[model samples]
Target: MTSPHSKLHISRSLNRFQTQITIFLPRVAVSKMTVVHIVLIKFRPGVAQEHKDTVIQELNKMKEMDCVKHHRLVVGTSITVPVERSKGFEIALVSFHENAIELDKYRNSEEHLRITTTHIYPHQEESIRFDFEVAPEEEHLWTFLPIPAEN
Candidate 1:
């Protein structure tokens, strides 16, 4: 009483089930974790070397301050197209902490204010910052998959 189409559908379903059983799958989970802040800095044109040096020194001092989990300064290695290339920013500060509140504390602290007003503002021309919260996948994806080491 079975039709030829029904027999063909049953054969295809069995083949698909067998194929799925032979494939390996990776395990992944959602993570509830801390957030991170990303800050980008650009300095003024014709800034003196001494001024740049001083500002860097002040920023480095933040390492001693609590709540700052990590901090780094990187000089731009690539230039953007269309825009006329200038000397570029003196430094880029990347900092990480537990949460946004701690980041706010660091931003509003006396030392931060003093450094900005005294050193960074006078010699700086333009600056920009971008902040983002880390997602669960981003917080733990590396643990399961190996990240290639950079040279």
Candidate 2:
């Protein structure tokens, strides 16, 4: 079963390319319009750090796309602790979009292809991508409810 609070909020994205508004019925259905996109990358042997930085720079350019949420696309090197758990993946990107449609636009954009094919894939030994819909926080659900007096 899904949480009720998830149905109380919807995502709206207004931009030069597209404007979208999604609605959810209160307490009965949830909107899955918000999307989180993540990518983890490991470069091949002898790939210079300088090249990696260039890749990150190109990835950051994705924020200019109107489909990206709040310019939330971020790219950085991993600071994972017990570093062994990272399995040699050194670079990562986390981005948010209003919906899957926006995500699709981002994926198919020319900039993404240029960056990946020209800069990323040549040195990319291993890469993983994960995308998912956002869920409402449990704490926010209690915000408007009355609290009983202390017993």
Candidate 3:
């Protein structure tokens, strides 16, 4: 439920499964957190699907930047249940960084500037950005068993 493991409950209501794990570590083990960056975009009226694709394609290139964490990024259409909750936003983007410092580097980098200025800022009606951090070990605990990863 908190950074560096204060208390947490891992659960899946579908199968009625739950597990709790809590542990506090010495200063040396805290290691920084993995940063998550998320954005939701609402395009202006009449923007072509091809234009949208170009924006996303450029955004996807950000994952190849040096500061990205595991080069992990996802861009997809909003599939919010009860579509009204989406507030007219049609797309979403999520990226992971090695830490807060890395996230900042990505945010302020020239590559980021070029991408946004050249591709994203001009075509958008409105956009929302959200970010958070997750403890690496805690994220691992989300699975009851180790699962093979492709990347």
* lDDT tens per residue, model 1, 1-151: 7333311111112222522122222333322344455444566667767777777788878766676654422233225553345335446666665566567667766677678777777766777666556665676542344558999
1 against 3, candidate with superior TM-score: 3
- Ordered by lDDT, highest first, the candidates read 2, 3, 1
Q: Each candidate: how many clashes?
A: 1, 0, 0
For each candidate, give its TM-score against the true structure: 0.57, 0.69, 0.69
RMSD list, candidates in order: 21.2, 12.1, 15.2
Clashing pairs in 1: 44-125
Q: What lDDT, from 0 to 1, does candidate 1 have?
A: 0.56
- Best-to-worst ranking by TM-score: 3, 2, 1
Q: Which residue runs of candidate 1 sit more than 4 Å off their true CA positions? A: 1-33, 70-87, 140-151
Clashing pairs in 3: none
Give the lDDT of residue 71 in candidate 1: 40
C-alpha lDDT of residue 145 in model 1: 48
